[model samples]
Target: MTREEREQLLARYTTGELTPLERERLFTEAMNDQELFEHLFEDDALEEALSDPAVRRHIMNTAPAPAPAWPLRWRWPVLAGLAASLVLAVILIQRQLTPSSDRSDEHTSELPSPCLLLSPL
Candidate 1:
């Protein structure tokens, strides 16, 4: 075949457009012709196939699923709740530590205990 015809056949093979017979013929010829083998080797067919969206989708579907993001979506809220709880705990601790001097003994002595109030008569 002329150089142009040879190049056209290579191009068809690159695009995966060749019949099984054509593919067999090309491979058989390539096995004997170092120059033709070099031409096919240099072609960017594998790159083109990998870049195709269908190939990418197939790879994605077959690959293991990535770790779930269920915790990530709740991370902010959980952190916020933890922070709020920490602050509330700190405030309660401070309240318990600092004794209030506002009307302690005098006011407490006037009120009856809840246990006596709630007891059966």
Candidate 2:
């Protein structure tokens, strides 16, 4: 491969996106070419920032301070209450539409259901 092609392949190899055959070619080229090996080494250094906690903390601390833990802890319970309310609403609607005869004391609607309009002749 030409110098530019070798550089592009080396960048892909550093990103771990190169196939095995491409990686082999990159390794072979790096061994024969000192400048390509230096380029790969520099790319490796750039990726080292991810695994370094000090750098990570410095980057994260630049943003606003995070919220307190209490709100985060209550988020699940709030979501569960909303879900339970939805389920209760659905059950109440279903009961109103088709109430059991055992509860005759409750005020029930006397209107003919719109459902009968969809019946086949």
Candidate 3:
């Protein structure tokens, strides 16, 4: 392979995109070429740096922050959904905690009878 072809192959190898046959051919060529061997070493070092969790984390931390998943225009709807969910949860909890009434008189006492209210008028 020419110098340019070797470099392209090296890139493919570094990115793990090379087939087994191509990898074998590259290594075979590297054994006879000092420059290709040095390129392989450099690629190995780069791969190691990329694979290390601490190095990856450092890279990620230094990178620019990504845009929010929900844009500003969508914020109100998201908040409204969250508020509705919270309200529903509170209502369900309140209903669950409140003791069920079996007494008819206790329930009747809360609302005025229509007939009694009409008689007074």
- Assess every candidate by TM-score: 0.34, 0.41, 0.41
lDDT of 3 by residue, 2-81 (tens): 88888889889978899999999999999999888988988789888998999999998999988988799988999999
Q: Could you give candidate 2's per-residue lDDT for residues 1-121 as a string of tens digits?
A: 7978986897688668999999888888888988888888777886798679998888788988877977888889999999999999999999999967866644345544566455676
Q: Clashes per prediction?
A: 0, 0, 0
Q: Between prediction 1 and prediction 3, which has the larger lDDT?
A: 3
In model 1, where is the ten-residue run with the lowest total lDDT? 112-121
Predictions: Cα RMSD each: 14.5, 13.8, 12.3
| Candidate 2 colliding pairs, count | 0
Q: Write the per-residue lDDT of candidate 1 for residues 1-121, one digit (tens) a residue.
A: 6667677789899888999988888888888889898777767666778789999889789999789867688989999999999999999999888877765777888898776446666
True-structure Cα RMSD, model 2: 13.8
- The alpha-carbon deviation from the true structure for residue 44 of candidate 2, after best TM-score superposition, in angstroms, is 0.7
Error of 3 at 107 (Å): 99
**What ranking emerges by lDDT with the best candidate at the front?**
3, 1, 2
Model 1 gets an lDDT of 0.83
In model 3, the worst 10-residue window by lDDT is 112-121
Which candidate's lDDT is highest?
3
Clashes of 1: 0
Task: Give candidate 2 misplaced runs (Cα > 4 Å).
Answer: 58-121
Query: What's the distance in Å from true for residue 38, model 2?
Result: 0.5
Q: Which stretches of candidate 3 lie over 4 Å from their true place?
A: 56-121
